[model samples]
Target: MLINDNQEQIAIATYGLTKIYERNIAVNEVDLQIKQGEVYGLIGPNGAGKTTLIRMLATAEEPTKGEIYLNGDRLLQDDTNPHLKQYLGYLPDDFPLYDDLNVIDYLDYFARLYKLSKPLRKQRLQEVLETVNLENKRNSPIATLSRGMKQRLSLARTIIHQPIILLLDEPVSGLDPIARLEFRQAIKLLQQAGMTILISSHVLSDLAELCTSIGIMELGCLVENSSLDNLYQKFSKQQILISTLGEYDKLEQQLKNCPLIEHWEKLSQKNHYLAHFTGNLEDASELLKQLIKADIPLHNFHCEKENLETIFLNLGHQQTS
Candidate 1:
C-alpha cells in the first residue's frame, strides 16, 4: 500500500526494495517513502548498506530487484516522465570533482550538462556559488580548495539544476568542527528552499541535529521507520537526575529498596545521583515523595531523555541479542 499516495508533499517511494550481489544480500526487501520538503535520515551502522540504498535511489546504479519512484514517476525508464530527472538531485558521500576546472568553470560546465542555456547557466552558477558560500573562491582551482570547499562545490553542482529531490549520502562526512557547522547551515538553506532531502550519515549526532524523519536499517531490514521524535519516544529510556542536600547514602538505600527504580548511580558528589526509572515514572515520583518526607534532602530533579546514540546502541543490541 502506498501510504503517501496523492500527497502533494511526496518525493521518493520504493516497493520491495532489494539489492543483491551474488550470494550476499546487500540490501534486503524494504519499503520506503519520503515526503517532500523534509530532511529524512537513513541511519545505520557501518556496512549496513545505507550507501547502496541511496545509490539506487539516486538513479546512478540499478537495483537487483524492486522499483523506485521519484516525484511519483518510475526512475530511469521513461524520458517523457515529467517527474523524472527534473525532480531529483543526488550528492554522494564522496563527491567527485574535476581538478582542472576552477569553481565557476566547474559549476558552469555542469549547468551546461543539465542543458541550461547560456544566460540561465550563468544565473544558476552564481546562485549555487552563493548558496554554498563559494563565491570568494569562484576563480580558485578545484584542486586548491579544501575538502570542505570541495564538498560545498559538489553540493553547488548538485543543486545547479534546481532539482526538487535530493539524495545526499553522508554530505558532511569529512569536515572540521567549524566546517561541519557551516555545512549544516548550507543544508538548512536547502531545506528552507523546500528541497526534499534524504541524507545518510553514520554520525548520529549530526543526523539527530538535521533530520526530522528517520529510517533505521540493520541486517537488511527496516527495523524502524517513523519521525525522529516518535522514534525517540518509542525507543528512548526515560531517566532523571537529582541532587539532595543530605548525603546520598540514605538515598542510595532508598533507591535500592524501590523495585520501580530499574537502575541508578551516584554522581560526582555525595548528594547527587543519576537515576534511571523505567517502569513507572509516577512510582518513582512517589519514591521521591517518601524520600522528601523522610528528611532526605531533595534539592533538584529533572527528567533526562535518552540521546540518539543510546537509542542506536540499544537497537543494535536488541537486534544482536
Candidate 2:
C-alpha cells in the first residue's frame, strides 16, 4: 500500500458547493477536500454530476451556491484574479486544438498567453514536451497527431504554465490500454513535481492504479469519500481459502461445528473451500492447528480481500437503493 502524509497542505476545497439548472440540481451540495501533491480520482456513472463538479472547480461554470477555495484563497469571488488562472489548470474530456499549429507552436502559444518570458517559454516548452514524452513529435502538426498523442499534447498544454492544481475530466476516455498506462505515468511525474490533481474517469481500473484517494459520486451527490486503503478496509472480508486433500463431505462434517467459520463455498471441483474466517492472524493460526488436530489434511490457507470494483458497486448500490 502507498502511504501518504495527512498533514499535507490543502490544495482544493469546496464547502456546500452546489449548482442548479432550470430547477434541476445538476450538482447537489458537495463538500470536497483534496491535499497538495495528491492525485484524487472522482468516479461515477453518466450524468452523475462528475463533469459539473469539475467545471465548478475549474471556474468554467459558476456555482449557484457555496464556496470554493484554492490554496486558501476564495475562488468564487475572483474573476479578475490573475493568480487563480496562473495557479489552476483545467482540461475537459474533449480538448479543442488549433489544427494549423504544430506541437511546439501550440505549447508556445499558451506559454506566451501566460506572459512567460520568451527565453523561459522556450525552456518550459522543452520541459513540457519531455514531461509528456512528446519531445520527438514537437514539430508534428496538431492535426497529424494520433489520438493518444493529442491527449498527451493537451495535458502538456495544461501543465506548461506549471499550475499548482489540475482539474481533469475524463482525461483518458478513448485511449488504448498502453496509452492509458503512459498517461498514468505522466500524471505521476506531475505529482512528483507537487501538482495536486482532481481527475474524473469511468475507467475505474486506471483510477485504482493512479489515484491516492477516491470520491464516489452518485445522483449528483458525493456518496463515498476515503483513501483507497480505508475503503478496502471497510469492505474487505476476512475470508480464508483452504485446500484440503480429503473428501468435501468429510471436511464439511468435521468443520460444521467451527464457530469461527461464518460461511464456506466450494471453489471449482478442486478440494478447496473459501471459508469466511472471522479471526486475526493468530486466531487463524490456532484454527489451522485445530483442523490439523482433527485429522484434516490442509494444503493451503490464505486470506482474501475484496477488490476495488466490488467496493465501488457496493457504494453505488447503497446510495441508489
Candidate 1 lDDT, 1-321, residue by residue in tens: 234646454678888888888888888988988887889998888778888898888777778889888766677644566458677788887667999999998888889888999988988888888889988999999999998889989899999999988888988886888778778888989999888889988778888898889999997777888999999889888787888888567888888887777889887786778877775667667877888877887888777788888898888998999
lDDT per residue for candidate 2 within 141-226, as digits (tens), equals 99998888899999999988889899899999989998898888899899888889999998888888888899988878998888
Best by lDDT: 2
Task: Give the clashing pairs for model 2.
Answer: none
State every prediction's TM-score relative to the real structure.
Answer: 0.87, 0.84
Question: Model 2 misses residue 209 by how many Å?
Answer: 2.9
Model 1: how far is 20 from its true place, Å? Answer: 0.8
Worst window of 10 by summed lDDT in candidate 1: 1-10
Candidate lDDT scores, in order, read: 0.83, 0.85
- In model 1, the runs with Cα more than 4 Å from the true position are 1-8, 77-83, 243-248, 266-273, 279-300
Candidates in order: C-alpha RMSD to true structure:
3.0, 4.2
**Native-to-model Cα distance after best TM-score fit, residue 105 in candidate 1, in Å:** 1.6
